[model samples]
Target chain A: MPIAITDPDDPRIEPYRAVRERDLVGRQHRFIAEGEVVLRVLLKQPRFEIESLLLAENRLDGLSDALEDLPPDVPVYTANRQVMDAIVGFPIHRGILAVARRAPLLPLEEFLTALPEDALVVGLVGLANHDNVGGIFRNAAAFGAQGVLLDHESCDPLYRKAIRVSVGGALVVPFTRAPSAEAMVQALQAASFEIIALSPAGSEILSRVKPARRTALLLGAEGPGLPRELLARSRTVSIPMSGGFDSLNVATTSGIALHHLTSQKDEKPLPR
Target chain B: MPIAITDPDDPRIEPYRAVRERDLVGRQHRFIAEGEVVLRVLLKQPRFEIESLLLAENRLDGLSDALEDLPPDVPVYTANRQVMDAIVGFPIHRGILAVARRAPLLPLEEFLTALPEDALVVGLVGLANHDNVGGIFRNAAAFGAQGVLLDHESCDPLYRKAIRVSVGGALVVPFTRAPSAEAMVQALQAASFEIIALSPAGSEILSRVKPARRTALLLGAEGPGLPRELLARSRTVSIPMSGGFDSLNVATTSGIALHHLTSQKDEKPLPR
Candidate 1:
């Protein structure tokens, strides 16, 4: 049964209050999942623990299918549009939201060791934009990149807007953070991963590069791109562009690179 | 010489007033260009006519190099950040803005006929989001897609947000709107262009499909992809994905598709 939340100030739904402001501040150990698609992904993924759900009363019937499998202890609160809007401090037309606790993160070394011998992953360095982070995760999921490794300077893929832009990819794809870009490269190299850093001045073009059994495509923020040291350390490849124009959005670059790296002619079927 | 304006309500800069509000309504025959990168492209491209420029006084030094070649008759207006923000009804942090006349749009038929014998282009259908439209344009420009064609249901690529997101690709790339998707397809067919529609249910994987001398990679919005009839009418291809995931941000799809379509072993270099 769904509990009715008539009062906007209800303490049971306290965590959902002032969403935009809370987004700027941290979500502590908990994060928000928004919209129908993301809520479905959260419900289906066992790694994330659902704390509760808040939905516009009218959205109840539509989400009944998703709510059927909800654990009894996890509360589902229903509110009228006005109360829901007031609770979140905005008119959230999506009418669906949830709070989920973050899963315990594994150490980078341990996580890399457990990967299949023919693993493919993405390494993000200094990518601060939430949209770009989310978009890369979405691409990573589509192209079947086993995991995503982010340097400390990169923005959180779990950020609310990033998750929303990723269309639930941030939730579906397994990811971890590293202390630094150099640390990430060292870790991947130790794990027998060929780290290919993407840059405009790369020595090789993207299409011609062959992927090793274990390949990690490394990307950095646009404009500044990857640091010179990282480029020199890794096998760098560039996507050929029209003359005098050498920029592609970081997320888009990941998609093109992943598509090529993962589409090897004799590649084995990906494990579900 | 730059004119100093202390007032936000100056009628000479009326076109920039309430920019957010005006973006919702059409900009008549004119469009606003924002940021330094886009402004540079606007200045370098002869197709667009610059009516005037508005900038924050502090940004004047950085833009002096770009403005040196400015035509004497084009007015340059500078104001303090406060007045500039108030005029645009937002914090215009980039501190550069311009109102330019839209270049006359060529008919879809004429535009198709003018392309080179081995032209590579992108065709957008029902893409209503500004960010996606802009991102697609950026990819098109990066991969040397000669032109972009849009159907009637698609949003205007020249919208302010679209132009800003495109990083000025909207200004540099040639595009034209068609009355309908079928009409756009008919025009391309008439011009001897092979139309390849991108869809999840596409018969062939993207990498295997060979491109014709003149190829048009057709893409639709994320959810309700290319219409069934349109899919039936065109040769369809899909980007292979992990079993359960079929979604790729439409713009990312364009980036991957453009990279493959434009890159050919015997392809000639793009004309500047």
Candidate 2:
């Protein structure tokens, strides 16, 4: 049974207070998860420990199946719409929120070493936008990429909005933040991965280039794309665009590249 | 010369007041464009008439080149940071905004009939999420799709957030709303298009199929997907997934599909 929290000011619901404001700071390890879909993903991911759950009373019956998996000690705090709104400092119409803490990151080298020889990977450089990062993770998961590597400048994938945008693919996709963009490239190269950097000024067409046994697709933020030095070091590829429209959203670029690299060589029997 | 306005409540700046709130109710023929990038796109595009522009005082010097072509009668209102914030009822750090009116939609049949013999088109069905709709337009523009056709249930591509997310690709990519999903399909078929519906349960792998000379790629909102009747009428295609993660963002799906369909048949010269 869930615990009824009558007062918005109750200490039990303290973790959820001023959620949008708190997201900017006090993010040592914990993160806020919003809406039913994200909360469900949070509950299923074993590496993240559920700190607490705050739910609008009306949504309790609807989420009973999801709640069944919760550990008994994890407190489920229920409040009316008004009370929950007061706690979160916004109108949370989705009516479900959770607090979860991730375990420390796996070492970049160790994670890369674990990939299979024929693995496909995506490396994100200076991707400050949360939505792009989330979309990349979702694409990576869908295309069955072995993992994603993010440079230090990339936004945290665990941010509430990023997780929601990803449909919680951030939790499922194995990823690590590299020390720097240069470091990420070196690590991939050391792992014998063919590092193909995607850029508008690329020297090779993406579709024409065949993927190596171990391939890594690199992307950067939209305006100031991957650094010149990085592009110079790696095999640069461009998705040939028509109509003189050179830019495609970074996430979309990843999807197209990943699909081409993964689907062409492999013959997975797609259900007819 | 740009007009300098000091008061936030000035009638000249009326079109920019409470922008987010006004977007929902007051959208007649008018739509808002935000940020330097979108505003630049608006200025260059010949279709949408720029009603007025509200810019923070500091950004004026940076936009001289873009403003050079603005019609003399078109008022460019300049305001300080404080006044601009008050006018929009929020902190718009982008510091640039434009109000533009769209010309009446071209008839769907007329637009489809005009596409070239080897045209590639995207048909969006019941795509309620503005971000997804915008993304599809961006992808369509990048891959040189002839045009996008939207069903009645789809969000207006001119919505502020949609326009911003699309990076103004919505304005660049010609699109028209159809009466219904069935009507959109019928129009595509009448245009001699080989209709291909993308679905997770699609009958054939996307990579395996070579597109017909005149092809239309149909996508729906994430959950329900293309209506069952629509799928039955068209050749269904699927992007293969791994790790049991069947879902990909609708926008990413469009990118992958459009890239494959367009890149395969064409031999566009690659720039070194």
Candidate 3:
């Protein structure tokens, strides 16, 4: 049986409400996502923990077949549009929103050490936009970046808009937060990483920069780009430009540069 | 001598009003821009043809110096946020809205034939988003993609959001719409251009694919990626995942990919 949540203050929907409370601990704040597309993709994982589900009165009728397979009793809630909006901070028109938990991250040391030799690591400098981060993560998944390394000043990857923009790449991509970009650059250098900062000024062509097979691409935010300190520590590689152009969004730049550097075509032909 | 017309129906503002009018000759719609950043950039152009200028009282003060530069007798309109919103059909808090005559595009044949033998081109395929279009144009300049070519389905490169997202790349980068992706792809092939389709499913990794010195990269919108038919006609290439990732946004991807192909990594030791 589904419960009706007519009021915004309903404690039964606490996980969903946590995101609405801005004063909640930064990391403690949680987010909720609804929609068949998002749910359908995420539900494929058997280990997924869904705290609760809110489906429309009519919408939940066909989902019984799906509900029977759930390992957890996800308390279902129903409401009219007004009631639903009251319960969540925003409108819940996407039909279904699940209060899924954010996974605890692995320690940076373990995340780095356990990664495979060919693992591609993405570290940010000062990416501020959640949408950009999420989009970057989405691109990372689409092009095959292993996981992300969040640096100081970067936006929370699990923020609602970020998750929505990333199409859940923020959830899927393995990541850990790093202290300072400068410190991370040094740590990566110590790990034998070719810390290449994507920039507009540098002459080292991004495609031609031979990362020692173990490359860690350092991306900056949209506007100011990587600080001098970060760039000074890393190999400065640039995408070539023609007339009337400037630079690209950091995430897009990351995707193409990563593809060019890591793909096999640019490398020596192996003996077949 | 900026004159304020009390009527939204004022004929003096017809060009400005028609900006929202549909199918006003697909090529001749009045262009509208709101906000200081876009207005500032557009003002820098010597060829900007103003229809009417609307400025919030504060913005009027901010733009007084630039406003004086406009030819005397150019019509000016003043309004507060409420009045501006009533006229614009949307809330525009930027306190500035400017209308201009659409700048005509350079003839495609003329543009193409004027190029040098080694001319670099930014060939776009089915890029549906105006923002992405503008952004790619911006990145094109930053990464050196020079002139841009758009497929038919692309939103007008000069669309409002496209111009905003491009940060004025539309004004700087020379772009023209191709009749079809097919015709353009053939023309590129005829030119001995190595037409590379950027895709996740590309058989050869981006790093491994040795593109011909003169190249055209075909990119489609996110999600759908490059079409299979288009892929059949061109060399399929992919950016290697940096972190076992998926793909980047079209503009970001283009920026990096173009950077790779265009960078001055000359003296690259010939492959063994």
Candidate 3 positional error at A174, Å: 2.1
| Residue pairs with clashing backbones, model 1 | none
Per-residue lDDT over B131-241 for candidate 2, one digit per residue giving the tens place of the 0 to 100 score? 999888888878888899999999989999999988888888888889999999998899899999999889999988788888899999999999999999999998888
Interface RMSD of each: 0.7, 1.1, 3.5
Question: What is the CAPRI rating of model 1's predicted complex?
Answer: high
Q: What TM-score would candidate 3 get against the native?
A: 0.79
Preferred candidate (TM-score higher): 1 or 2: 1
Tens digit per residue, CA lDDT, model 3, B185-230? 8767776666888888887655545556566778889888877888
Go through the candidates in order and give each one's DockQ: 0.83, 0.77, 0.52
Best by TM-score: 1
Off by over 4 Å in 2: A268-272, B8-10, B268-272
Alpha-carbon shift of residue B46 in model 1 (angstroms) = 0.7
For candidate 2, the share of real interface contacts preserved is: 0.89
Q: Rank the candidates by TM-score, best first.
A: 1, 2, 3
Model 3 root-mean-square deviation? 5.0
